[model samples]
Target: MIIYLLLAIIIGYLVFVAIRIGLHQRLPLALGPISLELIPDRAAKKYRERPIFTIDIPCHWEIEALKTRYIDPLAWSAKRIQSTAGMLASLLQHQFNLQYGERVAIFKQNHFDIHLFTISIIRAGGIACPVNGKLSINDFDPYLANLSATILITDSAAILKFLQSGIDFGCCRKLIIAEKRALKSEIEVTALEEQMARSYPDIQIYWLEEALLSVQKESPAVPRGKDDPLYLVHSSGTTGFPKAVILKNGPQAHAVRGWLCYVHLSRTWDKGFGALPNNHQAVILSFNSLLLLGFPAHWSSSYDHLDFNAEEVMRALADGKFTGYFGFPVTYTQLKEVPAEKYDLSAMRIWGSTADASHEVIQRKFVSIGNAFKAFGIPLKGSIFLDAQGSSEVGTPSVIRYFTRYTNTFDRRIGRIGSTPFGPKIRIVKENGEKVKRGEVGKLEVKGKTVFAGYWNNPALTYQAIHGNWFFTGDVVRLNKDGHLIQLDRLVDVIHTSDGEVYSLPIEEKLHKHPAVFDVCVYAHQQPDGTYLPSVAAALKVKNSISNSLLLHEFNQMLEGKEKLCRCEIMEWSEFPIGVTGKTLKRVFRNRSEQMMK
Candidate 1:
């Protein structure tokens, strides 16, 4: 009996250590080369056991950790940083007056700015509706009408523009302006405040700074439960008018917990750096992950500044000793054009590119960094690369892949698609809802903890998008025999020419390879004869002027015998319009092509 007791104690100790190692340390380490055995059939059973939550905002120096470890060594107190939560609590207490249980519409310049207010509104038991700042005045008015916002908080210029455009304020009873030095003199701030005081005596106009300092932080009130609607984010509006996607704190909290597991982040260092805009997933990942997980973050204000000079960024990384960095393909492509040794990037441990990157080009760039550059004939040392795959709708990241070897063939295998550690199921289904055979292309659907509830206030569209808990991603993809997902193309962007031949994303990828091409968009345009012709539009950053005819000749040489494209297809060149989200507005190019042909 004594011997049996001792043996049982030893077995229990071993099991505890195994669980700790698997959950916190070893899981993220094996993410790059994970196997089926590593993730068992009962993978999601743990998620069903209990609820875990965390929230952080690095700018405000707020940190909240639950069921995890945060890797910050600075030991900075939460009081030292500006508190976004505090700002919102003040707005609700003294300045703004919304009727009982009224919805507030927040139209800020970017995602991070809006988050400062949105989170507070949700905490105060009010609904938040965030509008995309990139939309034109015409597109924004209808949304405002639909939401019937009682208060409008925005920059001074936006207020003036709305008034000048003849928008009836109707139910909008208050306007609070967050003044910037650049616009302070141009727009008479005092005059506007005085005018609002007189014209609409009941309407209030308050400055952001004064309001924040005057009001004291109140104890958080009992908010609606996790299942109640907290906030709504507008979609990209690629297919048609944008729809608002509603989200609850419960689903978002669970999704974040799953991401923590998927990234294997407990033991990983918490340093987030990225150049992408706040309106996209780049900001969501960098801000949310850092804040919730107790990580430090460094951010740049503009994407263009980061894309032009990677050497400056590398030098900063060396100075700050950042362990992680994230950016788009353009940023990395620009880095490849420079001599990597000139910049001290030894401090970087993990680097990722979220936007589309050609596997061969990216690998070649890495090789040039770690090996010999033919132009300079100087050898360089390469760094490890981390890659992520997800969209804005999910609100959480999935499908992470890492590469250690500087091989060109890396893109041929899983260039982007990998599995989530949270046990979310990925499936490829044909238009008719049948599962495609292995290696066959079809629409991608994700059934996971991270998927959002649905488009906010647009029940008809929501019903169409989410069928029985599966979110139709609308992206064409395929699965290999090894179960790795491969993204093919966007179903909406596929072009069908008058000749009945189908041209797809490969042509666009090939066009982007040219050094002169900064960006490219391919779509179908109606010809003078009323027949749809496959057309390609490109934006050139290079200074050397190349004529349309010369471009056509080069394109024909590249796709001479390719079945997907015809030699006589039309091509146009213009500057690309970048949105606040740091995404190229491909729809703008499509609209331009339609107008030009007409």
Candidate 2:
């Protein structure tokens, strides 16, 4: 009897050890041929059960993870994300036949699957091509054809739209539908599936859930050189068709390291939040930064595919111990309407803005909201607003500034040029490549490892973009007496009036300071007499009693010389031509303004 009891005790002890080992097992992640085992940080053990990333979808939105799979898809722990992405990578490699150097086009909305799928693609040795999911079928068809991607990963809305449009699948032989719910439409999922199968009879169709459930051992990561293309990110296409920008393997690592040098990382306990569009370069790079730093972040989707509610964003930020909030300037413009007293924003340490330089008025409002630092263990009541001036071509921020509540500055100064070990070097030069004097606006050119490899499949255009070692940023800027770079305007958006060249941004900045103005777009509009003149379209605050004539007079008073506004149109925010990344499409607006004259 004693021997039997001892044997039972030994077996139980062995079982306990096995369970502990399984619990503490590290997950493997592959970047190129370099395999990295995600070792659990001892200090981060306290946060093991805590959510490292969250996706807060509105109740109205029908997402598969929210409706079917998980009870709480909000809390995606690090282990879960790593393990799932590893599995998905295996599925892509073995099941989907995704080979090294092949492009996997992600044409989905702002869903949680996007992050997983992107990571999986990297692990599987495929080039990730994230397209703007909000584009119409007519607009997106040619882009897919150009990429020649082997796999197309999208959601239900895309499938429904494709069926209606009857566009070919390009070179995409395999389709993986991540979500089954047809958002903003009455089409049934089954009907759409049938239609997709019928339309593309030769192509393979796979559901994301099936891929997730299937078991496959992780494949060996394919080797990649430093110059090998990592991902293909696209330009905003405000100028023309979206050009794919090739982001290479090694330079991206250097770029991330460069970002870490200046950008303040979040503390272990401090959660960050963002509502920026998933496909934007800002979001892609920032998310990568968060993962590398092991910082917790919650990314809320822009439900309407346009913009998120300011109240909802603030509510999410306030509910948790959040330290950061990030979005486009348009979201910040709307956030200005949300009163400070409505939410507890004291926990916020960093309010980050990118995609475009944020307005001074909007920056000041956010800077006054959260704490910059604690005063003797007591939380202070003001935050640091970080405005990072960059674009897809730059790949990383060229200039950055941290605006604290203590500093009351003027003008639309973006920041001083940033520096890192292998970062970008900026120079303001004339049309003939002559260096400009201080306070003289010239074309901005950048030279460094931080610039994107080149525009994909467009050798001629790529050659045109680069001059010697420098890449033209297509922006006009000047250096102030204080050695700060003040952004003037986009080269294309510069108003060539009868008097002289007028910058749109400075005038837009001036208009944004007014109490009644909510949003403003300043551009060169062709008048009836066939001359270009500085014009303005602005949206006013709710219940604003000011008339358009009165506001126009006030705005013009703030401007001087050639920059004076000739035409002012007060329109709803929705009426303005907005780009996918929430940038005001000035050229499109120029065409519309001309049409309005007729």
Candidate 3:
């Protein structure tokens, strides 16, 4: 009887509340920031708009304004991206029997065609897996097993290498070759293709050119929802080859569209510039946003073009080539190394760099770099440099700090990365999963509209990565009282010595501030006692007459009396091996440590 009375009381309260809300004329339901009007639906259901499907999402924005060209080897606009995508989709479905949700690995470099080819995979409702273009046959073996991808699409050289190696990639059933450049000897290419077909008779091979030219559009798109997986990108393998992580359609598009809206990429923005490889997440974010928002893509470079010099970039811009620029630290730093008077950079706006933070010299050079931009106001600048902090998994940036080279009040400390970008709620948490107070050092966790779904086909790793809705970024950071973020080091990179935990970043940051130091890498060296000691490996701007011992002695003065564990050593740039992303790998230091002793 008491239970019935309580139930009746709750029901009456709900009914009263509902009646009052129903009678109100101006009451709008608010969920977060979006407001919804709770109006009664009419009896005619047929008059309502048709349900939207993920497949209905535009494969290509069909915006001719969005163009890409390559300057080094030279290519022009990618015409009819939509029709070409449809044709490629037809080929993938009919020729290779590509099913929706199946994986196709694209082993290619950064190119305009790669984007179109990837878009085709999307239209076919297949997961587009693009690995590092620099991966050799040996590297491909492990990735092949990891991806278990049914189809492998690559250039002529890669396929030939795999065939010549005589390694059976058991998982892949088909090979699709895209030989855009016809410079390779026709007979040699033909012989290799023939040999590949014979060696791997089980794996059927086809050409992307044939698909584009011959295939007629049949069935349109594979039915998929917005929540379905879109692109399978890699984590930034600053340490090693990163795992394949999945980015979904619904959340990705939602997040990307919002970011585009915030950036406001209009016609006035003009041609944007970026040299990020197609495999890099920044490339994905850039092209996808530009194309989707009807903004133009960057000019395409030829297939044979390996790299760009600072002079080439400056001359291009000086010739009224591009309006916007997005470059990595090394690219911008090259421009910085040369005198600013060497090039005319006045046409450029929205200049920025990501991937890695700038060194002290690079930052100073950036100040020198911004001096060329003549257009600006009190609050605005002729040109701004975005020294941003973000990774592959997170599509949108977490922190972005802009710099005007002309500012008088500017502090040139590169320690502070910046505040958060659009999308993603970031929290600094303790090991116990509790949020750390401001000015406290803790682990970084993120969750938002743009965060990746999880690592591809690795449930155990995925489980470890994501806790509930928040993804553990594995970076250890400190939030200062000013709301700026300072990256100490990666959680795994944090060395635990007798001093408890020693962050390499602070030491690196300090050493980098030294006049002679250009760049440095810090790693924990295992002593004979089995206790690890922090070791600093530095590359200097120039070789001085001072001996190595004196240099070490001078550098060690910075770490004096604080921690007995750290030892400073300066090495030539050639000796300190850098990875593809330009990070000094700890593994290389470890591998050569014994050699160094000898």
lDDT of each structure?
0.54, 0.73, 0.60
Best by TM-score: 2
lDDT of 2 by residue, 376-494 (tens): 24455688888888888888887888888777675878877653334689998999999988878798889887688888878899999998979988789988778889999989898
lDDT of 1 by residue, 1-598 (tens): 9999999988876665445323544333233332111111112122221112122222222223210233442222222122335446446655674443466776655424554566556545667776756566776777776666787767666676665565655577776665433345545766766655655676677666555555555424334665666566666566556666666665555554555564422333435566655545335434443344444555553344223466776676667666556676556655555566676655454566664433445544553332112112224455456566656566554465656555434423443343555534667788888988887777877777657787765788878988878888666766666666665556766554555533445566667677666555566665566545555666565544576667767765665343233323233332445544344555665576668776
Candidates 1 and 2 compared by lDDT, better number: 2
The runs of at least 3 residues in candidate 3 whose Cα sits more than 4 Å from the true structure, single-residue gaps closed, are 1-79, 180-182, 217-223, 261-266, 297-306, 371-382, 406-422, 542-547, 557-575, 590-598
Q: In candidate 2, what residue range of length 10 has the lowest lDDT sum? A: 23-32
Encode model 3's per-residue lDDT on 247-267: one tens digit a residue: 877666554544453342233
- Model 1 residue 332 CA deviation (Å) reads 4.8
What TM-score quantifies how close candidate 1 is to the native fold?
A: 0.75
lDDT of 2 at 74: 67
- Highest lDDT, which number? 2
**Candidate 2 segments whose C-alpha is farther than 4 A from its true place:** 1-50, 58-72, 180-187, 303-307, 375-381, 419-422, 595-598
